[model samples]
Structures are given as C-alpha cells and as structure tokens.
Target chain A: MTKPVVLTGDRTTGPLHIGHYAGSLRNRLRFQDSHEQFLLLADMQALTDNAHDPDKVRHSLIEVTLDYLAVGIDPAKTTICLQSHLPALAELSMLYLNFVTVARLERNPTIKDEIRSRGFGRDIPAGFLCYPAAQAADITAFKATVVPVGEDQAPLIEQTNEIVRRINATAGRTLLPEAQAVIPPVGRLPGVDGKAKMSKSTGNAIALSASPDEIAAAVKAMFTDPQHLRVEDPGQVEGNVVFTYLDAFDEDRATLEHLKAQYRRGGLGDSKIKRRLEDILQALIAPIRERRAQLAKEPAYVLDVIRNGTAKARSRTEATKRDVVEGLGLFVL
Target chain B: MTKPVVLTGDRTTGPLHIGHYAGSLRNRLRFQDSHEQFLLLADMQALTDNAHDPDKVRHSLIEVTLDYLAVGIDPAKTTICLQSHLPALAELSMLYLNFVTVARLERNPTIKDEIRSRGFGRDIPAGFLCYPAAQAADITAFKATVVPVGEDQAPLIEQTNEIVRRINATAGRTLLPEAQAVIPPVGRLPGVDGKAKMSKSTGNAIALSASPDEIAAAVKAMFTDPQHLRVEDPGQVEGNVVFTYLDAFDEDRATLEHLKAQYRRGGLGDSKIKRRLEDILQALIAPIRERRAQLAKEPAYVLDVIRNGTAKARSRTEATKRDVVEGLGLFVL
Candidate 1:
C-alpha cells in the first residue's frame, strides 16, 4: 500500500519553540520514515499579517529550517519547501477563492479567535481574512491526504475540506482530496508564564535554538502555584505549569508519578519540582541547540536543501493545479 | 516628454459589443500611438463570476482578440496580453490584499451593484469580493499612470489609488504610482432594446463582429418610439435606440440633423429611419467583419500576438514586482 501524503508547515515568523516541538515537530520526526511528508515554510501566509515587515519573515525562514534540522526532521525523507517559491500555490489560491464565500470566511472560528487576539477588530486586512482559502490552496495543491496540526487548527482543516468538496461538487470531478487533521498526542504546550498557549509574540516562548543560559532563565521565571508559599504547604499539580511541562516532556513515568503524588500531598517545594522539570527540559533542548549552532554556520547547505525541496514541491503542486485547470476546461498554457 | 502609461482591457466573457467600441475600444485605438498602452484579456477576472463556466471564458479569449484586431487595435503598438499568463499580477494582488480591508471591499459600490445584479445575495464568492485588489494589481503592475474606464468603474480606480498610497506609506517607499481614471467621451451605449446599458447577457447587444444579416435583424427588433404608430406622427428621438445608434455611429452629422428635424416635424417614417440606420451600421460593420474573418483564419498569428505581448507585459510587471519586493526587504530569490 502507498503511504498517505502528509502536508504540514510553519509560518516562518519565528524559530520553532518547545510548544511546536511538543505539538507537531516531534510527531513529524517519526512520520518522516513512514509517510510522504511535505513541510513548508509559509512565508506568504506570514506576509498576510507581516506585510510591512517582510524582513522578519525572510530571516525566520532560515531560522525555522535550522530548528527543523536540529530536531531530526531528515531533509532526505521530507520535502522542505518555501511557500513564496511556488507560484502554483498563488495561482491555485486565486482559483479556489472563487468557491469560498465572504460570509463563510467571516464565520471561521479560528480567524475570529486570531482577530480577537490580534486586536484587529474592524480594520482587519483582506488577505488575513482570506488566508483560509490560501491555506486551502496550500493543503490541496499537493493533494495532501493528511495534515498534522494542533487541536486549535482543526478549523483550518475543515476549511480546506470544504473547498475540496465544493470544487469536486462544482466541477463534478474529484480534483482535490479531503485531508484529515491529525492531532499529536501532546497537543499544545503552555507558555512559560502558564498562559493557555505558547507563541513568539507572547514573550513566553522558549525557542528550540535558545542558549543554555536563556533556557535556565526561562525555566526559572515559569509560573507556579500561588498559595504554596512554604515547602510544607500542599501544591496543586493540576494547573502547575512545571508539572504540565513534565507531563509533555519527561519520559520517566514512574518518577514523574512519584513527584506528582508528593506535590499533591504537601512538602514538595516549588524549587525542587522546578529543578527536576528544568533538568528534563535542558536534556531535551541541549542537543537541539548544539545542532542548530553547527547548522547555522553552513547557510549554503541549508538553502540548497530548501531549494531542491522547493523544486520537488513545485512539480507536485503543478501537477495537481494542472488537473484542476483541465477539469475546469481552462486553457492551461 | 515621456508618454504616460495607460492600462485598459475587457473581461473575456463574450465578444466585444458596439457599446465597448463606442465607449472604450474606439478611444484605445486613438491612444495606442501616443500612449504606452497595455490591453489585457482578463480571463482570470472573468472566472471570478463564471467559475462554473470556464469554457465560455476560454472560447471568448479568441473572440475578444478578434474583436480587438477587427476594430483596428494595433497589437504591436498596444501590448495585448492575457491576465493569467503573468504570475506577477497574482503575487502583487496577494500583497495588495494586505492593505485592503474586508469592510472596505464590502463598501465598494461597483461590487455591491455586481452582487445585486448577479443575485449572489450573502453567498458571494470571496474572489468576486476581492477583485478590486486584483484589478489594482493589473493597473499598478505596469505602473500605468492612466486607466481608461467607463464612468461606473471610477470607484475601482479610487480603490487602486488607495492601496497604492497605503503600501507606499507603510513601506516608507514610493513603490507604486497612483493611477487616474479616464472616462471616454461617449459613455455607455444603450442596448438595442433601449436598456440603459448594453450587455452580452442581456441578449440585446450587437457584437462588433456581428454579420450584416445579424446587424439588420438586430436593427429591425430595436426598441423605438412606441406611441408613433402612424408614419405621420411625431416620433420621440430621445429614447429611440435606432437614433441613439445613429448618433454614435453616423459621421454624416448634416444628414443626421436633417433626418432628426424631418422626424420631429412628423414627416420621416420609422421604416425609412431604420433603413438609413441599418445602411450606416452595415457600412461600418462590413470592413470589421472582413478583417475578423481574415484574422480568424490565422489563429496562430493571433496567438503569437498574445504570446509576444504577454512576454513584454511580463518583463514590465516583473520589474515593478522586483522593486516592491526590494522595498519591503523581502528575499528576491
């Protein structure tokens, strides 16, 4: 049986963080061997929000690639492409836009949440609002059968599927396949400050490329139990960020269980628990940081991988786009 | 002094009608020698509304080109290009979309009118809604200083200028020049059935390529003064489509004035007037029909014109896109 095609990507607005590693990148490392994966540096989508700061998007492309390389995402197994490099994506997005309604885009829950978070209430850019369609193009342009994403991104999958179904129904041909959203086991990692989500703009993210000093500083400033002022007082593990981090990263289940029980029963000091969590995080991130530092010195090798992968990606996207254009009776030339 | 660049085109939904000739194409012919002109066959724009009927758009490409050639639009002087052939337009449109807002797009009177006319209430396609941006890209991609358009399209030019200003201000660079709208001397021509506007879908338009028989048939069925049942009755010339056609097409102003005076005084018969108008129309349309027939025989020649012109267009659009990318500090490679 053929391996199902998987499509996934980063916005390239910043380097990959622990939240990304825990939520998606870790799963991608394993999937690289079993599935046909296409990882994209979504610079075009980044420009939708950062149109005035394209330099940030440009710099982050290499930074994100270094993080991916450090995390053991084998370039030989997965195609790593840049979004702006593929003209087919832009063409497909314009074609797909004809099927999506303005009202439907307005009702996208993910977009609504993003708008609320970004505080762009009334003056939301048209590109930002229509990015769901652009994403539909990105997902379907490869005819991707599966999309690995966080739970919060489920709406994006739905929008892509809707465009797929709409095009198939309208064209009376299955030109695009409906892609399934695969949520990783450790769905999302909370911010160091215990926010519900970890993001670059939140000032709570610890990048995979963070130095040992930076990681130590971030771990020390992590939010913890408020009422546990003394070592003898019982600390809540349910909302404790250190425990959450331990749950996501710590592989030694027996020790974690013992620590959790002691914390609930009392007498487990916040500093002690934090130290253990810090040790686990350091061991996890130290190798990645080292690999990133080494890879950062070889920019040509990194760009060469991206260029080769983007060309391969362009071939696949072009084939899918050609099928869609032919199915629609449009002159392909 | 350098010639100001002028951009204009037609949506390839159907062959050009007499209304197009009288309003825009006629003016384009005159400006072709003096101005740096770019004529686009807007097949992509046609698809926004006719997504399900791309075959219609596809076939009309040749038909529209024939009309341009038949109407004396010099392809060598006036670069005739296809919209979809150049990827720069799509890329620029995506960037410009970041400057336009959904709310602002909703407020566009032309889009509002189109939605109402197309009966796309609430379910309007996102592409149709965002076409103003695409149009802006078409105009500013060449940095065209002037755009010849109908009076109804004045708002589209305003929207384009707004985006131009917004991008320049945001990027802190004057990347695109604002385009001015130039309305032709003879505005919209009335339909054969006396409608306010001539349109292909209305089934009341006589195409520029219509044969003598078709023109004669259309002239016979034209909406005239309903109250003038007898030849002796004074006929109203204000709303008569025959007289309107005569007013637009007939260069013999002395004869037309004499006929108008005779008709007002209740001496000219409707059949005689129709005959005179038909004669004038046949005389004007015969040479155009011959030219179209000769051009239609050479599809290779027509397509070559489009291909060469598209290459020329691509060069200019690429240069402008490069500057915009550089201004934003985006990676050109």
Candidate 2:
C-alpha cells in the first residue's frame, strides 16, 4: 500500500527556533518515517509580506534548510524543495484563483486573523490576500492528502478543499483530492519573555542553532513567578516561561512533576528551575547547533539537495497541472 | 535600431467581430510593419471571467487565430502566442502582486469600472480582480513599450507602470520597461440592436466569419431612425444605424456624407441606405469568411502556428523572469 503524502513547510523568513521544533519540526521528523513528505522552502510566501526585503528571504533559505538538516530531517527521507523554482505552482495558483471569490478569501478566518495581527487593514498586499489560493496550488500540485497545519491555520485547508471541490465539479470528475488538516499534538510554545507566542521576528525565542551562551542568557532572562521572591514563598507554574520550556522539552516527567510539586508547596526558587531548564535546553540544542555549523560549510551539497528535490517536485506538479488543464478542456499545447 | 515592441490581444471567449476589426485589427495590420508586434490569444484572461465555461475559451482560440489570419495579420511580422502556455507570465504575475496593495488594486479605475459593470460586487473572482497585475506581467515579459487599450483602460496601463517602477526600485535598476497605452482612433461599434456595444454573447455581433445570409439578415434587422416612416419624411441622421455603418465602412467619405445629408433632408429611404451598407459589409466579410473557412479546414496548421509562437514566447518570457528573479536577489537554482 502507498503511504499517505504529507505536505509541510516554513516560510523562508528567518532561522527557525525551538518553538518550531516543539510545534511542527518534531512532528515532521516522525512523518518522514511514516509518510511521503515534501518540505517546501516557502520563499514566495515570505515575499507576500516581506517584498521590500527579498534578501532576507533569500538568506533564510539556507538558514532554514540547515535547521532542518541539523534537527535530523534526512534529505533522502523528505523532499526539500524551493517554492519559486516550481513554475507549475504559480500556474496552478493563477488557475485556482478563478475558483475562489475575493470576498470568500477576505472572510477566511485565518486570513482575517492574520490581517488583524499584522495591522494590514485595507492596504494588505494583493499577494498576501491571494496567498490562500497560492497555498491551494501548493497543496493540490502535490496531491497531498495530509497537510500539517496549526489549528489556527485549518481554515486555509478548508479553502484548499473548496477549490478542490470547485475544480472537480467544473470537470465533472475528481481531478484533485481534498486535503485533511493534521494539527500537531503540541500547542504553541510561548516566548522566553512570557508575553506572546515564540516567533523569529519577535527576538524572544531560542533559535535551534542558538549558541551555548545565548541559550544560557535566554534561560537566565526567562520570566517566572515574580511573586515568588523568597525561597520560602510558594510559586505558580501556570505562566512561567521556564516551566513551559520544561513541559515542552523535559523527557523526565517524574522529576519535573516532583519539582512542580515542591515549587507549589514552597522553598523552590526561580534560579533553580531556570538552571534545570537551561541544562535541558543546552543539551537539546548543542549537538544540533554543531551539526548545523558542519552542514553550513557544504553549501554545494545543500543547494544540490534543493535542486534535485525541486526538480522532482516540478515534474510531479506539472503532471497535475496538465491533468487539471486537460480536465477543464483548456487548450493545451 | 530595434523596433519598439507592441503587445495586444483579445480575450479568447468568442470569435472576433467587426468591432474588433474597426477598433483594433486594422491598426494591428499597420503596426505589423513598423513594430515588433506580439498578438496574444488571451485564453488565461478569458478564464478569469468565464471559468465556468472553459470550452468556450478553448474553442475560441482557433476562432480568434483564424480571425487574425483572415484579416491579413501576417504571422511573420506578428508573433501570435497563447497566454496559458507561457509559464513565465504566471510567475511574473505572482512576483508583481507583492509590489501592489489590495487597496491600490481596488482603486484602479479600470478594475473598479469592470467590477461595477460585471455587477460582481463583493463576490468578484480573485482572478478577475487581479487581472491588471497579470496584464502587467504580459506587458513586461515581452518588455513591451506599446500596449493598445481603450481610453477607459488607460488606468490599467498606469497600474502596470506603477508595478514596473516598484520592481525597478526593488532591483535598484530598471529591469522592466513601462508601457504606453495606444488608444484606437475608431470608437466602439454599436450592436445591430443599437442599444449596446457589439458583443459575442449578446447575439448582436456580426462575426468576422459571418455568412452572406447572416450578414444580410443582420443589416435588415438593424435599428434606424424610428420616425422615418416614409421616404419623403425628414429623418434623423445621428441615430441612423445605416449611416453609422456607412461612416465606419464606406471608403468614399464624400459619397457617405452626401447620402447622410440626403437622408436628413428627407429623400433617401432606409432600404437604399441598408442596401449600400450591406454591399460594403459583404465586400468586407466575403473574402474574410472564405479565408476563415479554408483555414478552419487545416486544424494542424493553426495549432502549429500557436505551438511555434507559444514556444518562442515561452523562451522570451522565461528569460525575463530570470532577469527579474536574479535582480531581486531571489534564490535561483
């Protein structure tokens, strides 16, 4: 039996952090063994919001790829492709745009939430507004039946399915398959500052390639219970950044539970918890960082990986584009 | 010295009519000698509005191509290409969308007028709303300096120039040329019903391939001065459909002016003017109809023309896409 095809990727905007690892990367590692996976370097999607700074997106491509490699995403197991290199995706995007209405895109919960958070209002980039359709193109091009997305992003999967249904109805046959959103088991990891979700641009998250010193400094500054000023005072774990990190990264559950119990009962300090969390994080990131440094030296190998995967992806996507075009009775050369 | 490139085409939604001939095709014939002309079969653009009936766009590709060849558009002078077959246009459109804002696209007068006219309201197809960007892609892919458009469509040219400037600014050099809009001197031709513009779907258009009987029937049923019940009755020349056709078609300007004066002063009957109009139309359409019929018999030749031209266009457009991608510092594998 054929394994289910899974599509997942990150926008090439920045070096990914532990938040990405906890939320999706770790899950992707598992998917590589269980499914046929395609990891897209979404440079075009990054340009939707970062058009003025394409160099950033360009530089981030290698950074993100190194992150993927460092974290044990084997190139042989996962197809690592570049978005702009595949012309079929763009063609499919233009074709699928006709299947979706402007108001429908505007009304999308994911897009609406993003627009609000970005404060784009009426001045949103046309590319930004049409990204849902572009995403549909990416999903349908691969014929991926499983798409890993955050719960907040499930609406995009729905939008892709809508386009799928519309295309199928127009063709009087199922030319494309609808994708199911696969939400990862882990929720979002908060930033060290404990103020918002960990994001690359926010400068609050610990990058997967963070140096030892950077990790130590980040852990030292992590927000914990301010009310637990004395060693004798009882502490709260609900919003503590160190505890959150421990919950996400710590493998020894019994010790962590005992520590939490001790902290709630009294006589547990912020520095102790921070020290333990830092030790756990430093061990987690140090080998990955070292591997990343080693991989960064072989630029040609990285580029070849992208080139080969992109070439494979191109043929796959072009076949689907031809199928869609032929099914619609469009004039094909 | 290199000749300036001129880009123009019609939506492949139907066969070309007399309005297309008088308003653009005649000018295109002249441009063939002096300009590097590229005539596009805008099948992709037609899909923006006619997504539900792609077969119409598909079949009209040959119909419009036949119309071009029938009206004496020399293939050696003008490169006739299919829009959908050119992948770079779609790629460039995706790139340019980042340079324009949704509010800016919404504010474009051409798009606004089209939206209102189509009564699309909030339910506008995203592709229809984004067509200006796609058109900008078409213009710039060929580095076209001249784009023939109606007066109302001048705003689309302006929008394309805006994107060109933005792309150049982003590249820190002028990688793309701004296009100038060339409005045809002849105005829109009214339908046989005399109520609206001659359109294929409206059933009032006299197609370029119209038969002798069809031409005669259309001339007979055309709207004229309603009050002119008798040959001796003083008639209105301004609203007379026969006079309009004569003014548009009759080579002898002096004779047409004399006939209009006689009609206004109450001596000429509608049948006499209708007879004159029918003769001119038959003379105009008969050879074209015969040529169309002959060309239609050789589907392979027509398809070959499209194939060869589209192949040439694909290479040219791909080169531009590379330049833009490289200039923008995008990752080019």
Candidate 3:
C-alpha cells in the first residue's frame, strides 16, 4: 500500500527552537521514513503578519531551512520548498477565499486566538485573516492526504476541508481532496522563564542552533520552582524547568523518574540536575549542530536542494492545477 | 518624456455588453494609440465573488476576449493576457496584502457600498473585501501609470496609491509608482428595464455582439417615461434609455439634441425616436459585428494572440517581481 502523503510547513518568522522539536519538527523527521512529505518555508504567509519586515522574514527563511537540516529531516526523503515560488497556491487561495465568508474566517478558533494574542483585534491585516484558505491551497496543491499538526491547529484542517467541500460543490468538480489530520504528541516545553510555551518574541526560547556556551548560560539562568528556597527543603516537581526539559528530551525514562523522586525527597541539589540535563541536551544537539555547520558552509548546495525540491513540488501541483483548470474550462485549448 | 503605461482589465464574469463599450472598452481603444496597454482577463479577481461558479467565469473568458476583439481593441497595439497565467501577480498580491489592514479594506467606499448593495453585511467573503488590494497588484504588476475608470471605481485608484505610499514608506524604497485615475466621460448606462446599472444577472444587458434582431427586440422592450403615453404628449427625456443610448454612442451631438427637443415639445412619437436610435446603433454595430464574425473563424488565432501576449506580459512582470524579491533580500545567491 502507498503510504499517505503528508503536508506540513512553518511560516519563516524565526529559527526553530527546542519547542519546535518537542512540538512538530521531530514528528516530521519520523514521518519521512514512511510517508511522502512536503515541507514548505511559508514566506508568503509570513508576510501576512510580518508585512512591515520583509528583511526579517527573508533572513529567517534561510534560518528555518538550516534548522530543518540541523534536525534529522533528510532532503533526500522530504521535499522542502519555498512557498512564494508557487503561483498556483495563491491562485487556488483566491478561488477558495470566495467560498469562505468573512464571518467564517473571523470565527476560526486559531485565527481568532492569534488575533487576540497579537493584539491586532479588528486592525488585523487582510492577509493574516485569510491564511487558513492559503493553507488549504498549500495542502491541496501537494495532493497531501495527511497533515501533521498540534491539537490547536486541528481547526486549520477543518477550515481547509470546509473550503474543499465548498469548492467542489460550487464548481461541481472534484479536483481537490479533503486532507486528514494527524495530531502530533503535544509535548509542553517550559521556556527558560518557565512559561508554558517557548517562543522567540518572548525571548524565552532556547534556539536549536545555540552554541554550548549559550546553552550553558541559558540553562544556568532558567527558572525553577520558587517555593524550593533551599536544597535541604523538599522541592516541588510540578513547575520545575530542569525537570520539564528532562521529561521532554531525555531518552532514559527510568533515569529521569529516579532523578525526579530524588529531587522531591529534598536531597538533590539544582546544579547537579542542571548539569545532567545539559549533558543530555548537548548529546542530542551536538550532532545536529555539527551537521548544520557543514550544511551552512555549502549555502549554494543547500539552496540548490531547496530550489530543486520546489521544482518537484511545483511539478506535482501543476498536474493537479491542470485538472482544476480543465474542470473549470479555463484551459483555452 | 517617455509615454506612460496603462493597465486595465475586466473580470471574466459574463460577456461584455454595450455598457462595457461605453464605460471602459471604448477608452481602451483610444489608449492603444498613445500608451503601452495591458488588458488582462481577470479570472483570479472573478474568483473573489464567483468562487463557487468557476465554470461561469471560465466560459466568459473567451466571450469577453471576443468582445474586446469585436470592439476594435487592436492586437498590435495592446497586450491581452490571462490574470492566472502570471505567477508574479499572485506573488505581488501576497506581498502587498501585508501592508493593507482589514480596517483599511473595510473602510473602502466602493466595498462598503457593494456590501450594502449585495446584502453581504457580515457574511461578506474575505476575498470580496480584499479586491481593491488585488486590483492594486494588477495595476502595479505592470507599473501602470494611467487607470481608466468610472467615478464609482475611482476609489480603487486611491486605495492602490495608498498601498504604493505605504510600501515605499516601510520598505524605504520608492520602487512602485502611484497610478493616476482616468475617469471616462460617459458613466454607467442604465439597463433596458430602466435600472441605473446594466448587468447580466439583472437580465437587462444588451451584449456587445448582440445581433440586429436582438438589439431591436431589446430596444423595443426598453423603458421610457411613463407620462409619455401618446405621440403628442410632452415627455421627460432625463430617464429615457433611447436618449441615453444616443447620448453615449451618437457622434452627431447636434442631431441628438434636436431629437430630444422634438420629444420634449410634444410633437415626436417614441417610435420615431426608437427607429432613429436603432439606425444609429446599427450603423455603429454593423461593421463591428462583421469584424467579430471574421475573427470568430480563427478562434485558434485569437487564443494564440493572447498566448503570445501572455509570454510578453510574463517577461515584463518577471522583471518587476525579481526586483521586489531582491529588494526584500529573498535572493538565494
């Protein structure tokens, strides 16, 4: 049986961090072995929110691509493409936009939350509000049967399916498919400040490509449970950043459990635990950092990979768009 | 001084009608002599409102092209192309969309009036709302300097220039030029049913390629002032469609004024005016219809003209898009 094709992407807003690894990128790495994958660097979608800062987004595109390569994501197994290079995606988005009511876009849970969080309110950019339909185009252009997302992003898939249904119904053509959702294991990575979600804008993130000294400094400054004032006093594990990092990245589950019990028993000091967690993190990230350095040296080679992948992606999309255009009689011939 | 370029287009919603002839197509004929012209068949813009009925839009693309040819929009002087054929337009639109806020789009007078008129209210499609910005992309993709429009559409130019200002302001680069509005002398033509607008869905349009019999039938069914019941009854000429058509199409302005005076003086019959208007229409339309028939034989040639024009247009747009991409530092090298 042909493994279902999966489509996923990220807006080129910033470099990947540990949160991305615990959240979705790790799953993307695993899926490459069994499923067809199309990963996009969504610079166009990024502009919807970052409109004033193209320079920011432009640089981040390379940063995100480097992060992806730094992880275990193989370009040979996965198609990594630039979103702006495909015109059909935007064309498809314009068509799908007609099928979605402004009221419906306003009602999108993810978008609404983003609007509130970004403080855009009614002052949102029109492009930002319409991005879900753009995502529909991205998924449909790839003929992707599956999309891996977090529970929060499942609504985006629902929105894409809504557009798919409406397009088929209105055009009376079944050129697009409804994509299935694959919910990644939502691992909550505490920020350096002990916030629930690690993010770049908040300056709470530990970047995937941070050097050992930077990582060491960040780990040293990380917040721990405030109630545990002294090492002799009993510590709480519920809000501990060191324990959370260990839970997220440690491969030795038994060892982590043993360390947690010792810490709660009021005998383990914070520095010893911090050192152990840092070792585990460096062990995992050292090889990725080495690979990233090697890849960065050959920027031309990395770019060629992205461009070739984009061409491959565009080839698949053109076939689907040809059928779509033919179905609508836009084909002049 | 160099001659400035002019960009104009029609959304492929239906066949071009006499209203289109008086409104914009006639101006395009005049433009071909002095300005470099780019006439786009906006399939992508049509999708904003006609998202569900793509087949309707698809079928209209050919019909609209035929009308352009029939109306003597010269192939040698104008470049006619499809909106979807150029990826650069979509890419440009995506970049521009970021600079426009939802409040700004909502504040557009034309969109506000259309929302009230179409009864879309809050249920308006997001695409429908962003149309002005998309139109800005069409104008700027070719760096068009003169945009011919009715007074009602003048605000679109205002919105486009606003984008140009904001982009230059933020990007710190004066790459795009602000377009000037060229309001056509003759505004909207009323339908046969006496509605202020001639529209296809309203079933009151006389197509540009309407046959002699069809025009006669449509003219006979036209609404005039109700008080003009008898041949000797003094009539109001203000709302008379017969007089309206004469005002728009007739080159003999002194002759038309005399006919209007006779009707207002209670001596001329409606039939006399109708017959005279029919004669005037036939004279203008007869050669146009003949040219249309001759062009229809080589449908392949018509499509080919657009194909070659599309290639030329692509080269022009690709050059601009490269500048934009490079300005944003998206260049891989």
Candidate 4:
C-alpha cells in the first residue's frame, strides 16, 4: 500500500524546543521518507491565543522554519507551509461552523481542558473556543490519512473526523477523508527539575537550535536520584532522567551498560556519571547543532522555501476549495 | 462630491412579499439613481436560521433577484450580489470577531431581541450569535455609507461601526467608513388581516409577484375596521388596513381622502371599499406583475443578470478587502 498522507506541526508562537523535538519534530523528520508529510507553521492557530501578540507569531514563523531545516526536516520530502496562506482553510472552517453546535464546541474534551488549565473558564475567547474547528479544516483541507499527535491531542483528530463525517453527509459528497492518529512513542521527556514535562513557557526546555554551551548547561543541571547523597550510595536508574536520555539517544550499548552497573553497585559519584552522560549527549546532538548553524546563515533562503512550499500547498488546496464550493452549492456564476 | 455608497439586501429565506416591497425594494429603486448602490442577496445570513434547509435559500436567490428587477431595482445602476460569493467577507468577519467580546455580542440589543423572538435563547447557533459581526463585514466590505433598514435594524449598524472603529484604531489606518441607518417613513404595510407585521412564516404575506387571482383573493379577504359590523355603521379609518394600503400605493391623494371619508361615515359597504382597493392595488402592481411574468419566461437570462451583478458587487468588495488587508498589515507578500 502507498504511504498514508501525514500532517503535523506546531503553532508558531515560539521556536521549537527540545520538548518539541523529542515529542514531534524528530518523528516528523523520520516520517518524511515513508509518508507524504506536511509541516505547517500554524500562525493562524497561534492567533487563537496570541491575538494580542501578532509580532510573536510573525517572528516565530521564520524561527520555526529555520529550526525545521536545521533539524533535518527536508523541504523536498516534507512540504512546509504557512497556515494563513491557505484561505480555503478559513472558508471551510466557516462552513463547518454551521454543522457544529456551540454546545458541542464547549464540550470538546481537549479544548475544554485547555481552557480550564489556562484558567479562562468564563472568559474564553470565541476564536480560542473555535480553534478546534479550525484544526478540523486544516486536516480535511490537506486530505491527510494519518495525523501524528500525542495522546493528549487524539481528541483533536477525533473532532476532525466528526466534521468530516458530518460535512460528507451534508454535502452528499465524500470529498473529505477521515484521519487516523499516530501516537508518539516516547511520550514526553522530563525537565531538568524532574517535572513531568518540558516546555518553553515553563522555563524547563532547551531549544532545538540551542548552542553546545546551552545544552551542556541544561543537561548538567538535570536532577538525578534524590537518595544518592553519598558517593558510595547505590544510585537509582528506574526514574533517573539521565537513564531516560541514555535509553533514547545513547548509541554505545556496552559502555552505557557498564556505567549503569557501576552506578547501581555503588561507589560511583554523581560527577563521574554526569561526565559520561554529557559525552553521550554532546555526541548525539553535535550534528543537529552543526546543521542548524549552517541553515541559520541564510535566513532569506529558508523563508523563500517556506513561501514556495506554501504556494504549492495553496494550489492543491484551491482545487479542493472548488469542490467545496460546488458541494455547498455556492457557485456564483 | 461623488455619490455616497448605499448597501441594502434581502435575506433569501422566502419569496419577496409586499412587506419587503414597500419597506426596502421601494427605497432601493429610488436610491439606485442617487448613489452607487449594492443590493446584496444575503443567502448566508438566511442560512443562520434556515441552515437545515439550504436549498430553500439557494432556490430563492434567483427569485429574490427577479423580484428586485421586477420592482425596478435596475442592475445598470445597482450591483446585486450573493453574500457567499465573496470569501473575503468571511475573512473580514474573523478579524472583527477578535475586537468584539462574547459579552458584547450577547449584549447586542438587536441580537438579544432576535434570539428571544426566535426562541433560540441558550441553544443559539454561535453563527447566529455572530452574524451581527458577519453583517458588519457585509456592510464594511463595500465601505457602504448609507444602509437602508427599519428601526429594529439600527443596532446592527451600531455593531458594524463599533468594529470599523476598532479596526481603524488597531491598524492605525482610517480605511473603513461608518455607515448610517436610513429608516423608512413607514415601518411596515401590516398584514392583510390588520396584524402589525406581514411575515412570510406567519402565513399573512401577500407576495409582490402574486398572480392576478392570488392578488384579487388576498384583497377581497383583507381586514378592515371590525367596529363597522354593518355596512351602514360608522367605521374607524386611522388603523384600517385598506386605507394604509391606499396611503402606501395610491398616488392620487384626492381619491384616497375621498374614499377614506366615504368609508368612515357609513353607507359605503365593505364590498365597495374592497373593490376600489383591489383596483388601486392592481393598478399599482400591474406593471411589476407584468415585468415579473415576462422575466419568469427567460429564467436563464435573469440568472445571467444576477451572475453579472454579483460579479460587479464582488469586484467592489475585493477592492475593499485589499485595502483592509493592507491596513491590517496582513498582506504577507
């Protein structure tokens, strides 16, 4: 069977961080060779929450594109498009608003939880409330068969499929396809403070394009086993984030196994273990840093690629819009 | 000074009735000559309430256009357009949605009254709630300076101006113009049963394009003063619907006053007055009926006129969209 079309991206509120890389960006690069991929700089979606800060979104679009190129997300294999450039997505969203009830939107699990978490229970922006419908438009607009998202975002895909089913039924045309979710495997990387998740806003994330010094500083400060107070005390590896990073990125299996056994058997200090882990991290991240630095030299070319990619995305979307207009019976002439 | 622009429209929910004719179609015909007028067929607005049956709105677009032409709303002077043909309006509506709060939309006097009147209190279509914002887009899309509406529609204009002010202030550009309301002298022609309003849904409307037999039957059954139980008894003339129709359509002031006095002082039976009123209504509606019948024979040509008119309206709207996009700094390329 042909590889399924996959769509995923970040809202361009800021640069991609280590949390983003581990959660999605790295997976997107891997998916490119096997699936038809679309990496969107979702400026419009960013506006849902960042309405007062257009400058942030505007600047982030460039930063996000550069980060993607630096991280080996090939533009040739994965179309990187700007979300607002596709006007059809907004139009489709407006049409879908008719099929969806206001109550139904308020009941959307992910969006509702986000609102509650954001403490905007009574004062949610209507646009924020309606962004899920906008996401539905994005999925159906691309006609993607597979959507890669974390478990928390599975509800977004479910909402998109509901819209697809309703729109197809109403138009009496099967123009939009439902998308399947591809859940992330590693779940989430813990922050240096041993927090459950890493985030840019939480001051717990290292950026994808961070320099060697920044990464070293971040990793050096990471929390280890709390009870390993003495050099001779046995260390814990089960909940140790250093072991998690080693499990995810360390390539020297025999060396890492010896270090783990030495730590578990006692007598290994935290500094020695830190140095070993640091070497492993720097080796794994050196190439990503080099590639990103090279891409950053030509900001103009990166933007040009995004522009060209969006133009191609728009041409495909325009054809879909014609079908949508016909299906809605809004043919003017 | 160049002629100011006028924007007026009918919601394509049903056939045009005499209430529509006397209220708006009459003003549109006169205003077309004085201003650069755009008559919008607000099918999208109709869909807010009539969403379950979109075909009704789709089919009525042509009929509404025919009614405009039949009543002397000349396309040579006026541009008639379908609301959905211009996607820019929807885009404009989204931007305006941000400047407006949900509380403001809920507090809009016109929308609140309409919600209660339509029995859509809490179960309101969010689209229905936001359509005032949509109307703001429609009005400002053309940068229309004069909007002909009834007294009840005044708040919709206020809502539009609120957005216009916010847009201009936010963009630091005075691109959108404030539209003023143009209320007619007569609020409504009243139902034939002497009811306060003639609504299509109320089954009390006499269609402007009603056939000769339909018109004759409608006039014969029209409500007069109920106090005049006997033809010889004295009757009230002030609230009598026959006199109201005469006041609305009769150009001959002398004949109207004479008939009103004769019907008031007794001796003139209801049959005599009904007969005279029928002749007067026929005399008034004959040319419109003939035009409608003749246009009905060539539905294709009428459709072409609507197509051409919508194209012109769309072009005018696009010019405004370009200005707005530039004003908002949203023109990326």
Tell me the tens digit of each residue's lDDT in model 4 across B179-284.
Answer: 9998997677899888887977787778878777888898888888888889889888888888788788777889878877877788778888778778877776
Candidate 3 Cα lDDT to native: 0.85
Which candidate should be chosen as best, given lDDT against the real structure? 2
Q: How much does candidate 2 score in TM-score? A: 0.98
* lDDT score, candidate 4, position A250: 66
Residue A66: error of model 1 in Å? 1.9
What DockQ does each candidate score versus the true complex, computed on alpha carbons? Answer: 0.74, 0.90, 0.65, 0.43
Q: lDDT for each of the candidates?
A: 0.90, 0.93, 0.85, 0.80
lDDT of 2 by residue, A66-184 (tens): 99999999999999999999999999999999989999999999999999999999999999999999999999999999999998999999999999999999999999999999988
Ranking by lDDT: 2, 1, 3, 4
Q: Going through the candidates in order, what is chain B's TM-score?
A: 0.97, 0.97, 0.96, 0.95
Error of 1 at B240 (Å): 2.2
What docking class should model 1 receive?
A: medium
Q: Write the per-residue lDDT of candidate 3 for residues B203-274, one digit (tens) a residue.
A: 898887779998899889988778999999998899898888889988888988998898999988889888
Worst lDDT 10-window in candidate 1 chain A: A324-333
Q: How much DockQ does model 1 earn?
A: 0.74
Clashing pairs in 1: none
Q: Rank the candidates by DockQ, best first.
A: 2, 1, 3, 4
Count of steric clashes across candidates, in order? 0, 0, 0, 0
Error in Å for residue B171 of model 3: 2.8
